[model samples]
Target: MRFTTRVLLLQLLTVVAVVATSTAVFIGLSMAQLRDEAETSALMIARTVAAEPEVRELVAEEAQDEENPPAEELAQGQLQQYAVAASQSTGALFVVITDQNGMRLAHPDEDLLNLLVSTSFSEAMEGREVVAWERGTLGESARAKVPVFAPGSDTPVGEVSVGFERAGVFDDLPRKLLFIGAAALLALVIGLIASLILRKRWEKLTLGLQPEELVVLVQNQAAVLDGVGDGVIALDTDGVIRLSNGAANRIFGILDSENLTLADLDLADDVVADLEGGTARDGVVANGRVIFLEARSVDRGGQALGSVIVVRDRTDLMALSERLDSVRAMTSALRVQRHEFANRIHVAAGLVEAGRMQEATEFLHTMRSRGPVDYPLVGVELITEPFLQAFLGAKSLEASERGVSLQIREETLVLGNVAEVEDVATVLGNLVDNAVTAAVASDELRLVEVTLLDDADQLVIVVADSGPGITPGADPFAHQPKKLAENDQDSGQLKDHIHGHGIGLTLSQDMAQRRGGEVWLVEPGGEKSRRGAVFGARLPDVMEPDDSVNYREVQEEDK
Candidate 1:
């Protein structure tokens, strides 16, 4: 049977056993109670009969006779008439009057009128009344015996005995038992109904999964939650953290999550509110990791089971993605330069073949005058690092396609190779993208400018735009501009509408903070401001110190 059915059956059997035992006990006690009542009634009736004047006088005369009275005379005796009348009036089975020798003076049966009594009447003859359940000529009965007294003396004359048949005394037993049985049956039915209701409730709660199935499910869930790389946290409807996997515990620095709430964890108010509001977001920085987060509510059978927050780390993957994009950009730039260089070489060779030596030489001089063909952007040589050169070249191309001019400011300077390339790229990518976006929104001289500098292992990046600047006292990190999101060509999905410059700003700030740095708005411009907003980021330990020994320094000293 199913688990619920088993429980129901056990409960039903328990109710049956209890009801049956209780009913039987009531019946047994009732029989004794009824028998006691019958005996009391018989004793009272016998006492009244023995106390009568006629009965006392007749029994005294019969006891005084030298010879027993004639059987026929006693048989027709008025004493017998009195006994019959008493028996009829009292509703007793039989009533008998006996002499001192225990000879019957009066009896219900005429044949037994002058005969010796079947039961001992010593106690009655001694003037003592007795009540008992006894078997005599009339079969088993609850009987009472009493002694008759002389007219004015304490001397006992004869005895009176009255009995109620056992069957008649217990005549109400069946009815009482029937009532008890009805109650037991009602209780059984109630128990059955209660058990059935409980079974349904159990089935609904567990979705009819048996006990063994539930155990296996629980075990599997535990294994999966702990085994998976992504972080999982389960909260109740009240937002209390009921369960958390290993990754979540590590991320939040929680040793034990029992009875904790979202407030108890180290999460920002906005993040908490977003989670509570059942928001889904990706590429969010939390606790030094770029993670994808989504809060999903679970319900079953129209009952709310609360929500689960899933956190997947994308920090390493994003860094690799950026690096790949940079490589692709460099490869494209190289391929373009190769095709352009091949065309120029072909032209020069044709000029040389036609004996136009002066023209070919002038063409070579013109080609050499154009600084590196691999990077066509102006002041590209100012940024010496290959990664930065390629990354900026790609951004310049994107800006050029968007009808905006991207410039590497002439003042840009770096003393050493770039370090922490991925971290630097991530922050720069956001700031440059926003700057380009701002420039595109401007009608006057749409241009985005970038400045890169290094000061003792710190890489400082400043991006300026000619678009309308930020509003005064505004928090760019908290601003929500869906227009900027709608213009986003990345992801190409409607969900991008929820992501704004604020998300990028926040993510960038989080990355900077990890390196003991920060990204901040350096200049806030008004709507009509000629120069657009300027954003700066100071990333510590992103470049090598100039003081470090290198081949150039050693060669300079040798010279």
Candidate 2:
């Protein structure tokens, strides 16, 4: 059956049951009360007939005789007349007067007079009134027996018995039952009307969907929402969160999504603003993860529904981009060194061909001792790791090309192989790139200083420049990109990654934090500062290694 029909039927059945039970109880009590009324009326009539003064006098006279005598004609006639009148007035079936010996003196039928009564009369003769349903010569009835007394007499002179027919007592009961049945029917009708109204309301509340449809909808939601890898958040028109996927919960680091809203989550202001604006936003940082979000308004039949937000985590992609930048910087420096070496070789060849053999030998010796492209200004002699040495050399060359000086501090010392060199390079490389950009923009000397320290337990890199420090009233480690958009061009990061939208410092901080480390600004590069901004990144558990693998040896072994 349809759910609405079933509900209506149930309501009708409940009303019927209640009405039936109540009617039965009421009818039972009414029948009892009517029967009692009949018995009481019969008893009252019998007593009144027995109390007549003339009949009492005649009965007393008749009893005065010593010998047993027949009922006195005058007394019996008067008693019979009175009985007839009482029976007619009270609507009793019959009225009978019997002497103390149980011989009837007055009866409804004249032939029954002077006959022995068919039912018990002993209790009435002994001065006790009796009332019960009994079978007698008059037929079945609710009968009452009362003792008749003479004037100032304690003894019963005779007994008066009155009866109401069994059928007559319940004559009006059928009409009452008809009314009660009608009331039950009326109640059922009211209940059905209420059920119909309720059904309409229920349909509206459920959006005209049935119970089975609702169940299927819930099941589909669970299967689809939790299965997707990308995070999904759905909101109503009022910005209330209606649905949030498991991936969204994980991305926001929330334990429960119940009663959650966009404002309740610790999302970056830029990301939230973009979502509210109903536009697609890329490179938005949230919860230390590079997030790209697409927000689009949903509608049904041109009616506004709400919005759905899709979030993509791009932290790993941004890290890779930073590493690629480092490699590119190194490649450019190698090309410069290779071109310089080629020029030196050509010069030595020309000198030898001129027969100046001693000058060519000294020239080759000098080139070998000093090494080609020795950037003497940056203090590269103190750094020993080839990768770091080459990477910093490339950065210095790149800086000089941009008209900015890149300097390595004299106190910097890193003597062992870094276990995670790519991670370290990503952090320091971004810092150097940003510093170089800032130095190029500064009016003071265009110089950038770098400090690398590996103190066995941790790796620390500090980059300071001659440019203005960080923007005032900004937390350097925060994921806010407002300062970067205002003052920097994302430090010239990749175009595709969200971190490229000015999260360089945030990316470095996230990488360091992953290894139980931190990144912070030692000085804000603004107008009030003597020097440029200085940023420091410290990574714990970045210890020195006992041995290092050579790229060439590994390739030769594979061959």
Q: Provide the overall lDDT of each model, using Cα atoms, as 2-decimal numbers.
A: 0.79, 0.77
Best-fitting candidate, measured by lDDT? 1
- TM-score of every prediction relative to native: 0.61, 0.77
**What is the lDDT, from 0 to 100, of the residue 460 in candidate 2?**
88
lDDT string for model 2 (85-184, tens) is 8888888899888777777777888776777899988898789999999998878999999887766897887788999998999998999899988888
**Residue-by-residue lDDT tens digits, candidate 1, 66-161:** 788877898788898899999999889999899889898888777776788999999987889999999999899999999899999998888999
